[model samples]
Target: MLKQIGNYLKSKWSVRLMTIFYLIAGFNHFINPDFYLPLIPPFFNSHEKINVLSGITEIVLGIGILFYPSRKYASYGIMIMLLAFIPSHVYFIQINSCIDGGLCVPEWAGWFRLVIIHPALLLWAWEAGKSSS
Candidate 1:
């Protein structure tokens, strides 16, 4: 099963699908800024600007990962971006996984995102970097 997963990740279609995923996700930051705004921790000022910047970064890196030459570095950039988001995830957990007037979910669900989904995304990005290289 692990080998099958690896083979799937290494496929060109997987990379393309990842490309589309990030592109849409990045644009969603703009289309639904309110959704992300509440998720931003209070320590960060100018939430609007931060949201724009994050969106732009995601869009740029998403585009960059589509090309063979830039795939590795772009993937690295994505990894860094994900790392930068750790604080927000921690804050979510700290706040009992509920954002007032924002996202509200079970605490365990938040932990699952931080512990499981996040790492899975990292692995996917890493494999994207290696695929077709």
Candidate 2:
């Protein structure tokens, strides 16, 4: 039920799992830079540098979340990071193509990410912060 799921979200293990998810995602930013490059909106002056910095930021936030005392702060950082990526999501919808091509999905998926998935992630980070705090 929803109540049970809510309770689970507040649990410490959930925090740890989410922490690991961030860590892996951050690492992937470096491991698979090519996948991210095309997604960068053309307005940005330095796509490569921005991508690396974002990866580093994620890595640090992941480390922060791994520790109990820093979890709340890290959760907030995660929420902010998610917010920061909103424009890229918008760009994806505008472009209507996969970042590097080959895995193209319908434009609806792009809109879905912005309208639904992004908010869900924000809520997830908010819950994580509240519970960890």
Over all chains combined, what TM-score does candidate 2 have?
A: 0.89
lDDT for position 58 in model 2: 86
Regions of model 2 farther than 4 Å from truth? 1-3, 100-103
**Which residue pairs overlap in candidate 2's backbone?**
none
Error at 99, model 1, angstroms = 1.8
Clashes of each: 0, 0
Cα lDDT of model 1 by residue, 57-98, tens digit? 999998988899999998999899999888889888999998
Point out where model 1 deviates above 4 Å: none
Tell me the whole-model lDDT of each prediction, alpha carbons only.
0.89, 0.82
* Structural similarity to truth (TM-score) of each candidate: 0.93, 0.89
How close to the true structure is residue 132 of candidate 2, measured as C-alpha lDDT? 50
